[model samples]
Target: MKLLIVGATGTLGRQIARHALDKGYNVRCLVRNARKASFLKEWGAELVIGNLCKPETLLPALEGMEAIIDAASARATDAIKQVDWEGKVNLIQAAQKTGVNRYIFFSILNAEKHTDVPLMEIKHCTELFLAESGLNYTILRPSGFMQGLISQYAVPILDNQAVWITGASSAIAYMDTQDMAKFAIRALEVPETKNQTYPVVGTKAWTAEEIIQLCEKLSDKTAKISRIPLGLLRFLRGFTHFFQWTYNISERLAFAEVLASGKALTAPMEQVYEIFGLDSKETTTLESYLKEYFSRILKKLKELDYEKSKSKKKKKTPFKSSV
Candidate 1:
């Protein structure tokens, strides 16, 4: 089957493309940057340059495509509406016009119920639109991405320092991007998944504090986690508003609510495994993923240090006679 993968250059998108290629499917990646598209080409994917913001660019790419997996969107609420809602609408219209059969959408868990968060609310709107779009569709509402947590928490731990987080006690379900990609591929293959909304998560749930402890154990470092106060979180939310145009009032309010109410725990990982036969072994524990993520960060830090030292040596050199 032929497929079009939007946002194929991103973290999750890259994994999805690799998984699709492994399945021996003909994959076409719709990307904005040619350099990023080249990487997918090296991975054996046909690269198609397009922009989700401009629907006109997508119609040519959508031609002769059987399915479209939309991983494109702005994580902030304001951007979500513009890109997720409006972009999805544009793609659906183009798909309908082009006679595309299936559209797989990546949505966030608790989007409908969590109206206070701007991003979730916008996603909810997109889900609602898809439900009424009169097209065969599958929606996967994944909880917080496991990678997001690792990036947020593991950096400080690896540096032998504490990390400050808002909701340390909330036990949220996290899913690896690989697992989510497997589910997406399954949704593309399984007829039963069409017209349904599935929640994708990991085999277990973990609190932020627990995750911090796990990082400490994995790296053999003693790291403390300090919970930022609600008031401080609210202030930071507002502060972010000044700098973030697409993620303003609603997004800030939603972030504050998530921290205050601990709205992270909602989905279970069992359903994902049951539907796709994706065993728990496929999902790496938080500690394992964090170890690798931290290692990369440390490597970059070392490179930066080397560059600084080279610059210092050059500066220390006596001025040569440059006749």
Candidate 2:
């Protein structure tokens, strides 16, 4: 099948593109940068240069395509509206005009149910638009990304000896981006997935404290975990907003509410395994992933230290004073 992947340069989008190619689908990547497209070309994907803001540019790339997977946009409210809502609307129009059969979208879990959050609201709105667009559509609402945990949680603990978190007790199902990509690819290939919304998540759920404990066990270091209250997090959100960082206050508040409720994960791993044909039983525990992550980080830090030492020695000339 011929497939066009929007946001193909992003972390998740790239994975989905690669997996689609591996599955023997003809893949076209819609990318904003030619340089980014160069790498994707090396990965065996045809590149189409276009921005999500300009829907007209998408038509040529999307023409005669069997499916379009939208993984673009930031997680913020404004970015979501611009890219997820507007851009997706444009893509739907183009797809209909170009005779595309299926439209698959990557969305966040609980977006429809959680109306109080700005990000979720944007997602909900986009889903509504897709429903009324008269196109065959599948919406995949994936849980928190495991890759995000590595970047947002584990790296901090490894580098700073602590995991500072906004919502401490929130139990979120985290999915490996690779797994999510595989699921998306499978959904695209299967006709049963059309006109459906699937909640995709990892094999298990983990709280912030539990995650930190697991990381500590893996790294064999007692790292501190600092928890910020909802109000304090709200303040920090304001500070981040002042710098124009792409975070929404309402979303943060919604996250706080989720934590306060102490709810378990709603997505089932068995469904993921059944769909993707992987033994989803093999868990990516927080401990195992963090151990591997920190090992590489420590190696890089050591390399940097060696480089710094060598530079210092080189700077110490014969005339230079030895302290």
Candidate 3:
């Protein structure tokens, strides 16, 4: 089947495109920056230049596509109205115009539960539009990404600093983007998956302290943790909105607020596992994720240190004038 991956420039979208191609599906990526998509080209994905915020540019990308994976997201709050909300509405219209089969949308878990949150509210709006569009659609609400959490704390832990969180003792559900991409392809492969809304998550839920322990074990270093009280987080939620004209509530801050309220619970994994048998590798555990995350960071730091030492040596020998 021919598939179009929107937001193909993103990590999740790129993974879906690559996995689809590997499965022998005709994959086309709707991308804004063709220069950055050279890697996609090398992987045998057809790149179509278009912007989701602009409807006219979407026509070419939507034409002759069997399905669309809606993976687009705005980088900041300013573009949320345009990209996440309007962009998706535009894409759905174009897909209808082109007579597409299935529309697979990626939304975050707890989006429905936390409608007051700015990003979640926009995502909920898009989800509703897609459902009422009368098209064969599958909406995936995956929990927090493992990569996102790891990247956020890796530097702080490496620097021997506290990884401050607002979640306190609450548990968080972490899902790997690779697993999300795999399930998206499965939805395309299975006809019964159409018109369904799934809450995707990792195999287990973990508390902040549990995750810190895993990180400590992997890095062989003590990790300081500072968790903000839930009461303060609640106040910040309202306080940030009051001062919206001055300071923008960041994604991290927004997520911390959500977690502190104990909203980030693991999805119903048994139901998902019943349909698609669990592959241990894809449903990664917190321990495994931290180990790999730390290993990669250590390797990169070593490479940087090596480069610096080489530069220092070159500078030391450069005092002799070239004659």
Candidate 4:
């Protein structure tokens, strides 16, 4: 299949392109700067110049595409309405106009529950828009990425910095981007997955406290934890909500109340697994993932320490060279 992957430079998008290419699909990455995305070209993907914010530049790129995997979202520096809302709608329209067979959209888990959150609301809206666009679409709503947890929890705990978490008892079934990419590319071949929405989360759900403990066990380093009260997030959201310039700041606090609902961001994966022809056991778990990360980082740190000590010893020793 000829695939057009939008946001191909992003974490999830790159994984999708890799998986699709590996599956013998001809992959074309619609990137803003071909030079910046030259790595995709090296990986056997054809790179095309296109910007989501420029709707006029989308159609020619979408032309002759068999399928589209849209993983694009607004960055912290981007205007929320331009990219997430208008840009996405235009892309969907172009795909429909160009007769793209399958459309796969990556969305957030339980986005409807967080309507006040700018990105979540945009994702939910885009889901609805794609559903109504008269196209064969599959919406994969994945929970948090385990990759993100590396910096959020692992690095901080390892570096002995304050790992911030809300006081809410919220647990998330974080999925690996690589595994999630499998479900996405597999959706192209699964007839039943067309026009269906699946919550593609990990095998196990983990809370903030549980993850901290896991990091502690794996890295053997205690985490200096700081809890931000949900009330404070709510207050900040209210303070920033009405300001036009504070949308970016508001995005940070938007999910605060949603997660505080005492809900686990997880769903039954039995059906999703069966539909996507994926094994639940093969999914990466929080424990194994964290263990691998901490092991690698700690080893690197130890190697650095050894090198530093070795250099110090060399400097301390009088020149033993025959002079």
Per-candidate local distance difference test: 0.79, 0.76, 0.80, 0.89
lDDT, candidate 2, 1-323, per-residue tens:
99999988877898898888888999998887888578789989998888777987988988778889898866444455577677877888898899888888887787777776666777888888887888899888876777877766676766765666655366888877777788788787676778888888876788877887887776666767776676776565556556545455545555555554556655766765666565665656555566777788778889999999999988855685779
Candidate 4 local lDDT, residue 220: 89
What would the TM-scores of all predictions be? Answer: 0.83, 0.83, 0.87, 0.95
Error of 3 at 136 (Å): 0.6
Candidate 1 lDDT tens digits, 47-129: 88887778899899999999989887764433656776787788888888889899999988777777767777778888888
Residue 319 in model 2: shift from native, Å?
Answer: 12
In model 4, the worst 10-residue window by lDDT is 252-261
Residue-by-residue lDDT tens digits, candidate 3, 205-228: 877777777777778789888877
Clashes of 4: 0
Q: How many Å off is the CA of 227 in candidate 2?
A: 2.2
Q: Which pairs of residues collide in model 3?
A: none
Predict model 3's lDDT versus the native: 0.80
Clashes of 1: 1
Give the Å shift of residue 52 in candidate 2. Answer: 1.8
Which residue pairs collide in model 2, if any? Answer: none
RMSD of 2: 4.1
lDDT of 4 by residue, 1-323 (tens): 99999999988899999999999999999998888899899999999899988889999998889999998877778887889899999999899889999999999999998887878898999999999999999999987889989989988987889999888858889989999899989999999988899998998888989999999999888999898888888889889979979977787667666766679999999988987888888988888888888889889999999999999887855567786
Q: To one decimal, what is the Cα RMSD in angstroms of model 4 from the true structure?
A: 2.2
